[model samples]
Target chain A: MGRRNDHSRQEIREMALQVAEKIVAKEGLQGLNARKIASAIGYSVGSLYIVFENLDDLILQVNARSLDQLYTVISKTEQQCRQPDACLLALGQAYLEFAMEQPQRWRTVFEYQRTKDAEIPSWYRKKIFRLFKLVEKPLLEFMPTLEPHLCAQTARALWGGVHGICILALTGRLEIVGADSVQNLMELLITNYLAGLKNVQGTPCTPEEGTTQECKA
Target chain B: MGRRNDHSRQEIREMALQVAEKIVAKEGLQGLNARKIASAIGYSVGSLYIVFENLDDLILQVNARSLDQLYTVISKTEQQCRQPDACLLALGQAYLEFAMEQPQRWRTVFEYQRTKDAEIPSWYRKKIFRLFKLVEKPLLEFMPTLEPHLCAQTARALWGGVHGICILALTGRLEIVGADSVQNLMELLITNYLAGLKNVQGTPCTPEEGTTQECKA
Candidate 1:
């Protein structure tokens, strides 16, 4: 119990986050609290407050780490696929896999809310934007003529749809949609959305035009 | 206090639900509990149990009502817009409007979870399936030759996208996407998704082909 003084502040902070993540992963967000974290790490509640502003701050840090890990997963998909469309499909699949694998932690990223009026911290916002850029990079290549602003918008909308599918499927609400696996649904969503994006931009290389050569089969 | 015995059992049940909705609407799901509901209704927690099995049961009932109200809002859009495309757009807009208007309650519909592995009750499932049918009706009309199963999947996908947009926007995560309003994002989603569906089916009338006549501007 007295071991708290042995570790430096940074070490304590990192240890607290790891313990918190494990709690959330096992019991979901409802299970996380400062007391639990402090006790698990053999620290006083007072010491826990010294490192973070409040419980919300602690949760935000945990979510930020989750987002970073998610960004890493999505980034890896980019190197694995050559085409932008294929890259997006890979990213979507990776995202779904991450959500399924770490349902609690991944959900806490979106489900955790601060007070209504509090601004999202800029550092966290930066991480979210970085995640968007992962999608935007390939989208811009796929639709070269899309305005910079429109490209960002398209990226958010598409990824939001992908996220929505993951949420519904994981939550069991997706059962209403029938027997298709989440992977098949993700493929359908990405394929149709890209087809629509191409159509909107008046791009000549339609998926239908040359299914094998132009689009990933 | 004197009015408690004056009402029938059904009236008491309805009153409890209305009170619970206000709590959830104002303070979110975390704020809801039988003690609070009983206190507000001037009844004992025992009476609450008589009407509902537990807090989860009460929440499920509340969610069912929310779904029914949502279905009504969407159904009204069907009458307001004659074209299937216009009707779907109207439905999407109405949905976003509903979410914005009652963000807390609308959120509880998706956010509330039963205890692990408990089957979602059939009555509630029926309400959810009914909601899906609302979308399915207009979708089937839009693409007549679409297979029945495909129509169901497409409806779920498109609505899931709409739902994703609402979740992101209402949570303030949409700020990263830029200056486009939620309505604009909603229009973009439905427009492009329908375009993709039409393309996938090789339909003769593409939105891009006749932007003014076939699709909403």
Candidate 2:
């Protein structure tokens, strides 16, 4: 009886998440209410509380699940390519493809407000590092001499550019630029970013070095 | 009495937009509704309808005004920079800055949905073009050899990348990739995109381009 009850509890939480996703996808986060979700699942409001502490907790669970899914998509893409730059490009493409495919889920992951401030939680931060490590670790092999900080910064720039393209395409604002083929543009962007990495790696340490030396002197 | 009534009509419309902005900023777009807006302005719901056909129409009007304000920001940024590429970079930076500074208004632009999808009216299209022409016209000066269609596609690609970054960064997803300074990343992206324009302008068609002729032969 205990095992069966635990399984049922898990089932109810999954169902609640599905219904919440449906509500957010259709009516957006604003339309999401516990009563509405319970009604959607044909359960009483009290049943929802059994699974989730409150509405905010439910949203955080959904948001975390969505991020995990997004991370999985990027990881799968990275594994398909062996070359450092190719792997990085694949990760960027996958990130773009995921955002375009799941616009509502993508929005939910970003738009949901959590209690955590500027610093993300440790587990979430690990997932983030895992995603970057896929690109950054391979990149170290190709550009063996790059400083860790610069490598991370370049990875971030490329990632930001890809993330930005996905949002623009999904939101329909890309029309302002008169483009249709997101895939081609993304490829070109990744190519350019990779090329720029060579330059950034070779960037003179004069400015950074000067500041530090002046401070010390 | 007729002239006074007309003046009051304009005053009410402006007042409604102000209240709507306040509601959205403080509580998110979900907080905006007729009753709350009317209560905030000390007006009856009927008075709101005098200037707005419905709540959707009111939101649309407010959106139009917001987009106009957004365009004005772009224009000011462009005017401050003389070089075509610099102008594009400045405009993009200003855009990201605006979204970060006023995240609520930025989200309202992306997240708020129109109630109906009729033909896009002329005024709306014009508003869209105003932002585009800032980049399209000046970009043409720099890439004079490229055809119009190609130019539009390239411009859209650049615009899409920048806009996507702003949305993702504002929503906390960019933290996943460890993006530190959005402004510096945007500068690097714009510089790289401008550099790549040379190949698009000067390079002769490669074998892939002449495939139709080769296949016929």
Candidate 3:
């Protein structure tokens, strides 16, 4: 191992995360561990621990970086399409592309589980929330009078559906139903979901059955 | 271990699967292993190998059974709700309920990955398809003019969205957006997706952008 004073703390931290991401990219999350990362970065495992609390903490940081990259990718969709619905479709397509391009890294962000009672750190939570904000802006533009909480809820529901399509398609579960392509399924989801949202504002005759059912209960 | 002659091959296969399911249910897929299953069932590891090809095979069988149970749960929704849209909502609720009630087993159906290039057995594929068939029935009834392939594709796209919500909610990822309940999010997904489908049939002017785009491409 190099001398402890040889590299600044920030340098070492960046180095460790880079090495960790490489391991996950080449080999799935099951292949990642401290010893391999330390060896790859030319540092002792002790030094690795000095920079992060534990493996879980290291994974959380890696996931945070992934979320940042995803946010950047999805945000770019905003400049490509003029219509709110079109922008959401472009965002869903970008998401599916990212997952296909970086399967392991993308899966790592969702697959890493904390201990049952452990809380997700606030910093990590904030990174994920930022991703949702990209969707929220376009949604609010579509429905100007929608309450803030309902806006957030609508964004989550819509994004959650897109996220689900990507997960099933990437995981091969989509094969059971004879799905042709991730792109097609994603387009279907975004188009249908946006259509439904438009219907809410266009028609007063068709009540929001989901909300009505909730109110009754 | 009991005498090798104490049980027939079918008996051993059934016993091993039961034990494996319990382990997965209590500890998630990471905690499952052949040694653990054998010990739990009071059999030798060799006996496990005799009944199944390996741990992957055992997991496939267990997952197949989980899918069967899921199909049963979703299929029951058919009898409870006569209307196509209402039935789809009931199915979504049952799906969310199943995921919440049996998080491990439901997750294992998706989380267990076979070795790259290993084909999922036909039996397992058929069980999963039956689950899709439940969704397909209601979808076709709602859109009788929809082509057969489109019906299958629509079923997959809609159900994939529901599955995604369950995965995110069950894993605590939805907490970032402060999701109220799995039931509410699921209801939103089904209602919107169905609404979108209804619009496709009700309005000749809105052009199915998703399908039209595909044809143009």
Residue lDDT tens for model 2, A1-217: 1232444878888888988987876776778999998877777789899999878888877767777888778878755876776776677778877887777777777777766643455776777677777667766776788678766765666566777777767766565335666776676666545544454444444443121111221
Candidate 3 lDDT by residue in tens digits, A1-217: 4665689878899999998888888897889999999888888899899999889889888888888888888889888887777778888889998999999999888878875677787887788778888888888887676678777877888888899999988888777557878777887777677667666545555453333322423
What residue pairs clash in candidate 2, if any at all? A164-B164, A164-B165, A177-B156
Model 2, residue B92: distance off in Å is: 2.6
lDDT of 1 by residue, B1-217 (tens): 4566777789889999999989999999999989999999899899889988788889998988898888888778877877787788888889888999989999899878787766787778888888778888888888887777777777777888888888888877677445266766666677667767767666343553122211321
Model 2: per-residue lDDT, tens digit, B97-177?
778777887778766666656444568767766777777776787678756766666676667667767777776666665
What is the Cα-based TM-score of model 3?
Answer: 0.89
Q: Which stretches of candidate 1 lie over 4 Å from their true place?
A: A1-4, A53-55, A115-118, A176-179, A203-217, B1-5, B116-118, B176-179, B203-217
Provide the TM-score of chain A alone for each candidate, in the order shown: 0.89, 0.78, 0.90
Cα error, residue A216 of model 3, in Å, equals 7.7
TM-score for candidate 1: 0.85
Off by over 4 Å in 2: A1-61, A78-90, A116-119, A135-146, A175-177, A195-217, B1-11, B38-44, B173-177, B199-217
Model 3 regions more than 4 Å off: A116-118, A205-217, B205-217
Return the lDDT, model 1, position B96.
88
Tell me the tens digit of each residue's lDDT in model 1 across A135-167.
889888888977787777778778888888888
The candidate, 1 or 3, that scores higher on TM-score is: 3
- The DockQ ranking, best first, is 3, 2, 1
TM-score of each candidate structure, all chains considered together: 0.85, 0.75, 0.89
Top-scoring candidate (lDDT): 3
